[model samples]
Target: METFLSNLSLGFSVALGLQNLGLAFLGCLVGTLIGVLPGVGPVATIAMLLPITFSLDPTGSLIMLAGIYYGAQYGGSTTAILVNIPGEATSVVTAIDGHEMAKKGRAGAALAVAALGSFFAGSVATLVIAALGAPLTRVALMFGATEYFSLMIMGLVLAVVLAGGSVLKAVAMILVGILLSTVGTDLETGDERMTFGLIFLSDGIDFAVLAMGIFGVAEIMRNLAQPESRDVVRKPIGRLLPNREELRQSWAPVLRGTLMGSILGILPGNGAVLAPFASYAMEKKLAKDPSRFGKGAIEGVAGPESANNAGAQTSFIPLLTLGIPGNAVMALMVGAMTIQGIIPGPQVMTGNPSLFWGMIASMWVGNLMLLVINLPMVGLWVRLLKVPYRLMFPAILAFCCIGIYSINSLPTDVMLIGLFGLVGYLLIKCGFEPAPLLLGFVLGKLMEENMRRALILSRGSLSTFITEPISAGLLIVSAVLLVAAIIPNVRKGRDEMFVE
Candidate 1:
């Protein structure tokens, strides 16, 4: 206890420094703006900011980056609620009811719920990180390659549960995502899997390109194809904050979502993405008016919005404590640490308390900073809904192209993005959801690596995956989830979970 207290004190001292505080504010501000912008997610934003972290104190840099991450998520719910366009895949569940509320001219109520819920979640998740950091790292360290493989398998199956369309179509899209992931050079044999002899295929498709093409460019194509007469009601957006009645209905959801988000956020692979959806599903199951879920339940916005923020905040646990990045933003963090000559791993706390604790303290401060920036800026965000599509699309597309090209500096990436844009459009036309495909692609590379590593470690013995304790546990849970996802009776109730 003494040791922990001493470290916490030191962390607080460093984090409260004026420079660190300012950076935290900067990150939150930048993050919110980007989050409100369509297609430019925290991952791409963090990647773009990687070069800028080189000169700062580790505490300040990490705090700012983490701020960007959670802040973007906060802003994401706004767009999801107001415009029906999810700021990122994580906000899809939020859009289900949030946008419905907006359509009903309760955009202000939805925004208030999303923002406040996120703030509460961010606060609780920060505490969760502080309390559970060591134990979670201990749990994570027990996972070997075989266990990781099983975990990835579980995540892939869960992706299907969240697909939200035809099951067959969702599975097909997942397969396509996996195949796309295989386009890069094979690690074991140094041979291409599906590169089609194209030089761009050597590195596979960057997630940014795939995501941008599918969501950003394809969305543009879609809007242009449809007649402009469809958009009739501009959300009236009466008030900026929720009334007392809404506050009463929301507190429980915020708490539940925060707890769920913190736990799920720390899981490897697509856990952070799953946090919001899981929270939304849980909220509906627990709601008094379950039928209001799709139509316009404030709890729907509150829970998922809180979950996404908490998940975003807590995702740093693995990256900071274990050197295992759960997502792209965490990966960039690892890179930033590496650039600073600080190797991130179990020993980081022992070797660099200032960095570790300062980072942790900065997260709490950053979350607070996000609330300050986001609440007042809600008006500015709503104004964005009035921007002309022609200007917005070009700007969004340009940012997407730049982000994709910077990953490998290849023109072929642009072409692949265009191709995926077309594919995404077709998928949209066919009523297939794009999120599960993105999730599948997100897990694909790691899934392949873990599978190969496990096989190699076990000398190609498949039984080793089940024979091990951690691996067996994950596989068993996966089996249970798959069964639940597939069973006909259960499917009728949670049908939203079992499709494309």
Candidate 2:
């Protein structure tokens, strides 16, 4: 405890320096802006801005980039809540209830809840990083390919819980997503499985393109088709802050999300992406009225948003302690550190205590900056709803196009957005939820990669997943969760049949 305190004090001292604070603030500001823009994710932003950080000290550069990472977590929900377009993958579930809340004239409350939840989660995760970084790093190291594959299985099973209706539809969407994830060239053999001879598809679909097209474009089309429904957003703006009751309801979910995210973020291979989904599933399962989900449940927004931010912060654990980058953004961080003559991993703590601890300390400062930056802007974001849909949607569509195009300078991606938009609209018409598909798409590639690796290591032995202790345990849990999710639907069907 004494040593931890001393290191923490040292971290704050370095992070509190004027230069570091300025850089951190700048990073957060830039990050939030990019995050609010659909399809402009932190990975692209960080990659582009990385060159500019060459001249700064290692600690300062990392502090700034780290700010962009978690700061984006705060801002990602803006579009999700107000416009139904999730600016980040982590914000996807946020859109489910958040946009619903917006339509009900609770935009202000939803945004406030998201910002506050994120800030609280970030603060707690930062402390976890400082106090438990070493032990957690060891825990992360224990996850091998077999274990990771089993964990992904569990995550996919949990995705079944995301649907508010029709378990079959949700399962179907997940299968479609997994199929789409297989479209790119096979990594080992260089064989294109489902590209259909299209060069653009050879690289596989861009997630931002998919997300923008499916949510933003489809939503715009839906609004245009039903002009009367557009007026729902123009409802009187209520309290700009969450009421006392709102706070009371949000606190438990925030705490639960923080704990779940902190634990998951320690896993390798971008386990953070699963945090919000897991939190959402947990929240829905625990809700007094589960039917209130997807329509506009405050706990849905609060829990998932908290989990998203907490996971974003804690993902740095593997990078800092094990020299492993958990995601693309962390990979860029590795490059940044390497360029600064700093080798990541266990040696960094002993070699450059100030830099390591300072980066850890800056996370807290960065979260505070984000809260200060986001909370005041909630009103401005809510005001955007007052604009006529006729004028606003065109701007949103144009922005989506520009953002998708900017991702790879590919006009085809812009075209793909249109294609996915139609697909999204069709899905909506058919009563399918897109959330399960999105999660499945995101996890599918990682799952395949890990599964293949595990198989190769075990000489194609199918029993390796069962023989590995951690892998076996995860599979067991997945089985239990799957059964639990399915039994409810079956029971409901039986009751309805009897009623009929």
Candidate 3:
């Protein structure tokens, strides 16, 4: 306890320095801006800005990047509340009640609750990281290839559960993501799998290109296709903060979300994505007025928003401590760290306590900066809704094209984005989620590496996967989940999720 406290104090000292604070503030400001804009999310924005981090001090660079990540989580709710569209997938539940609240002229209140809940959740999650990082690292390093693969398999199954659409469609989308990841040269054989003899295809799809194509461009296309009606700005703005009764109602949900996020974020795979759904489900089950959920319940916004941010923050611990990224953004973070000659493993703390703990403490600073930046700017964001779609669409298109092309200076990437944009739109039309597809794509590279290493070590013995207890148990769990997902009862629920 004493050592942890000392480290935490050291972390805060570093984070509070003027330069770090300024960078944190800058990151949150940019994060919230892009986050508030329709069709923009953190991953795309982060990838676009990644090159800038290369020139920064590692601590400041990471602090800024981490801020942008969680800061976007907070910013996403603003758009979700003011508009029916959710900026983040985790904010879907928030959109349920939050947009309704906007329609009911309580947009201000909903936005306030989201920001406050996220800030509170982030603060608590940081403490959880301080207390749990070392222990979780120990736990994560125990797994081998079979275990990792099974864990990923289980995550894929759960992804369908969280995918909010047809399980079959979700599975299909995941298969597509895996297929996309396989486009690069085959690792085992020195040959290309699906590169079509094009030099550009040899490196596979970049996450930046894939994400911008699917989420950013595809989202813009969807918005343009649907004619706008019922201008949401029609609602009158309410008070900026929740009332006492509202506070009482939200506290329980906040606590529940924080705990749920802490647990889910520790798991590998797309567990972070599932965190918000779990919190929303729990809140709905625990609510006194369940029917109020779809009709604009405060708990709907409070719980899931808090959960997403907390999950986003806690997801970092695994990436930093074990070199295993729990989500796409973490994977990107790992990439950034690697470019700077930092290897993520048990040695990270021992080798670079300043970077590790500094990041921990910086998360708190980032969260604080988000609230400071967002609260006063709530009215401005609300006003941004007044911007005409005709103007916004062109701007969004410009951003997407510029962002995608900046990656490799390849018009081929732009073409790829167009192709994936069509693919993503088709998946949506068919009731599939693009999020799980991303999870599959992000993990595929690492999964292939681990699988090959384990195979080589075992002299090509396939039995190696099931021979170890941890590996065996994970495979067993995945098998059970796969079987369970096909059960009549489960299938019925899955089919109903088509609206997602």
Candidate 4:
């Protein structure tokens, strides 16, 4: 307890500094704007901004980035509530009831509830992160190469299980990602392996370039292709505050969602993506009038928004502690850290305590900033939504091109965005998600490195993986999970759950 308090105190000292506070505020502002722009998610925004962070201090830059992440959770609800356009995937459930509320002239109240609920969840999740950080890092520190390899295998298995749609497709995307990760020089031998005699290929694909292409440019393309009409609420937003009955109904669901989201967010395989959906399902099941769920039930909006925000904040745990990204957004964060010369892992806490805890503490502050910025600025956000998609698409594409080009002044990087943009579009068309591919790509190099080290230590003995207790246990669990996920009944149930 004493140590936790001491560390938290240290976090506040760093996060509350003038410069760091300003960065947090700026991040929140930018994050909210991007979130309001439908289809421009935090992944693309952060990828675009990575080059800018090169000049900033690591701690401040990370604090700002963390702010953007959770801030988007708050901002994503605005479009969902006012226009039925779900700015982020996490807001899809929010749109069910939120848009209904907007249609019924309760837009203001719904927006307020979402922002406040997100704030409460973010605050709670921050505390959870601080509490879990040291212990999780200690656990991570004990992992040897064999254990780490097995753990990563478990993570990929979890990814396959949790991934929506066909298991086979997800596995194929993951394999492709692993293959992409190998398209560079071998670390030990310093020999180019998969370069195909191209100089650009020799250095491997740039994470930011791939991310910008897959998410940024591709998102622009997808959004441009979609029908542009939106049923934006133009009437006077009713009272911004929830009524007594609404508040009364919301508090319990908010609490439940925060707890559920916090727990799920800690799980591997982008569990945060499941948080809002799970909360919605639970809320519907628990409601006396389940029929009200899709008809503007305040609890639906409040619960899922809270869950989304909480999950976004808590998903940082794996990235901070175990040096593994649980989702695509965190994978971008890993790229950011690597670009900044910080090798992520348990050592981050002991080696860069300020950066670690400060980022955690800044989340609470960022949430507060979002709450303050979102409510009064609701009018601005709604007005911004009136902008034409045609204008937005070109600007986004140009900005992405500029950002990609600036990375190394390589025209090849810009061209790669075009290539990957097509790839991303095809992935969507083929019913495969781009996120799992990105995660696999991020984890591939680490997995291969650890597997090699573990094999070397074992003198080419394949049984060593089973002989090590931790590795054996992890592999067993992973095998069980994979088998369960593949079972006909289990797979059907899983598919149904995600479909909801």
Query: For candidate 3, lDDT tens digit of each residue in 1-500?
Result: 88888899889988999999999888888888767776667775665565566568888888888888888888788878887777776677788889988888888888888998899999999988888876766676676666666555665666655445466776887788778778878766878888888899898777667876776667766767777642455768788988998899888898899889878876655666688889999999987778988898999888988888889888887677766566667756765675466766656777788888888998988888888888887878767756666677777677677766765689988888788788777766767777767767766766677778888888998798889788788778777776776686576778889756
Residues 146-190 of candidate 1: C-alpha lDDT, one tens digit per residue: 876786676566656544556667678778877777878887799
The alpha-carbon lDDT assigned to residue 111 of candidate 2 equals: 88
Q: Provide backbone clash counts, one per model.
A: 5, 0, 0, 0
Which structure is stronger by lDDT: 2 or 3?
2
TM-score of 2: 0.62
lDDT of 2 by residue, 1-500 (tens): 88889999999999999999999999998788767755556765664455456668999999999998898888789878877878798999999999899889898899899999999999999998898765655565677888878866775675565345677887898799778878878879999988889998987876666666666677667667764322325565466699999899899999999999998887654468889999999999999999999999999999999998999988898678756555656756766786577866666777788998999999999999998999887666545434555765677677677666765788998798789889988898899976566656666776788899999999999999999998999899878977887898899999999999
Which predicted model would earn the best TM-score?
Answer: 4
lDDT of 4 at 391: 81
* Better TM-score candidate (1, 3): 3
TM-score for all models, in order of appearance: 0.72, 0.62, 0.83, 0.96
**What's the lDDT for candidate 4?**
0.88
| For model 4, the run of ten residues with the poorest summed lDDT | 484-493
Judged by whole-model lDDT over C-alpha atoms, candidate 1 comes out at 0.75
Best by lDDT: 4
